[model samples]
Target: MDVLAVEVLRIPMAVDLAAIVIGALTGGLLAAREGFAVSGVLLLAVSGGLGGGLIRDVLLDVPVVALTNPVYLPTVGITAMVTFFFSGWLSRTTGLLVGLDALTLGFFTVIGAQKAQLAGLPVTSVVFIGVATAVGGAVIRDVLLAQRADIVQPGPYNAVAALIGASLLAVLAGPLELPLLPVAAVVIALTAGLRLVSVLRGWSAPVAID
Candidate 1:
């Protein structure tokens, strides 16, 4: 129960590293589809997996754990290797990765909000960081692949779900002052539920008129 900030909850390092693996899974799948070599897979994995935290730390002006931590790079590397090998099977197993992405969405969100809380940011900024942490990696992946950021275009409720999760955390952790683990649980469940339902029901964010 090592605390990082006054009254702010610090999630376990294992959980934090797990989010990186899940995010990198998405990148690894994409690289496999493109027939990239092992090195390229590792690159996209780092970008898609670790980029968000990098962005968050930079904004916070704190040390970058992705680069600094001894365990982080290896975690991403192993994930990329596994994903590259299993890309075929994983692609065939429809909804598996999607479910994982949905499930872990809250992890990144809560961690981002937690970091912002450590920095004493206001609620709005906290929510912003949360969503950024959840989806910033994907945006970087798309950019590196020479495509548009899927989030900017019409898509499902990925960011919206993250927003809801981060906002809930802001409310519970800010005004209500609830316990950290319970609040994080609620946020994660709600965000994942929203995302999963949206995907299953084919819900998409509204776009401008044609």
Candidate 2:
């Protein structure tokens, strides 16, 4: 692989790890609030934390992290333990969980875009992969819990925020040739901030009132 490809791969792995951590924490809190047992919490943590990456990798024809990487297992395990140990503290602050979820969404979106670019996918395809990466886990989680997926629901532009972030990364990658870490950080920050603002302000996509 070329130097740029090597650099892209390394940074996205780090970002994926960070996303897993955030997902595990958020999933743990949700599971605790739902009165899940320790096993259930751990299950949710693993599923929610790594589900998207699994889907993304499979779609991209790469090895799935949950099956191939030891790091993913321990990361989710640690997150579950921390949440179980501090259940009381986290159960009281639901907002923090939502914020972390948003951050994870942003992180995964960028990773998907970066990976798509490395895989030689078109820009539009890369953007689609990014959206799938950001929302796939939540979709799986909700299905397991028998709840609606937030990304598809009429909420404050969750998937749209991810699309924007992925597009930004792809655009930046094309011209400026910014390093993956800095580009990923900027994309994640902007996307998360946009989602937070939308949540706070009750923003939503326009609807026709025929």
Candidate 3:
């Protein structure tokens, strides 16, 4: 593992674990809706849970955390299995899905920015990597399902929320010398707030007319 990978491994386990479970649940539910079998559901869940971090790690030229960490892949598998078995009960809770998605978005976005900053990437690269980490799994899931990538298409401020948080973190923690934990908390709150509000308000980027 590279230095960057080692740094990522030291991140707070709570944040990483929460994000993984939420991401896995989101993917598993989508797979169930798509009528996938157990294997396909597990596949999608793991992809969704780990895909963003893996992409970010690759971009940073670091070892993939999920691949190297025994805990991560197992967490993904267990979350997927639980989501699969309880999907019927979970299906009724749209609010739960929305909340989990927003939480996962926040956690991943902040972690990505933190990791990229530690890797000594430029501010622009850090922000981009943060957004990529926030949505990479969903992008992979959409591609696998042959659907339009929500992050790229017109959507409810998904990547925009990530951009807001990542840019703020890059500014606050990079030059302002703010403490990391407080910055992370604020970033997560902002990202989750933006996402949830956008969903509730039906906010979207302006459409282009040719």
Measured against the true structure, the TM-scores of the candidates, in listed sequence, are 0.91, 0.86, 0.93
Using lDDT as the measure, the top candidate is 3
- lDDT tens digits by residue: candidate 1, 1-210: 135643333577677777788888888888998999888899889977798888888887888878878888889999999888998987786578788888778788888888887678998999999998888888888888889888887777988999999999998988788988899999998999888998999899888888
Estimate, for each residue in 3-79, the C-alpha lDDT of model 3 and write its tens digit.
75566665578878988988988899889888899998998998789999999999989878889888999999998
lDDT of each: 0.85, 0.82, 0.89
Cα RMSD (Å) per model? Answer: 2.3, 2.6, 1.8
Worst-scoring 10-residue span by lDDT in model 3? 1-10
16-129 per-residue lDDT for model 2 (tens digits): 687898888877778887999999889788777887777888998877757877788998999999998898987787787778778888888887787778888888888988
lDDT ranking, best first? 3, 1, 2
Give candidate 1's whole-model lDDT.
0.85
How far residue 104's Cα lies from its native spot in candidate 2, in Å, is 1.9
**Regarding lDDT, does 1 or 3 come out ahead?**
3
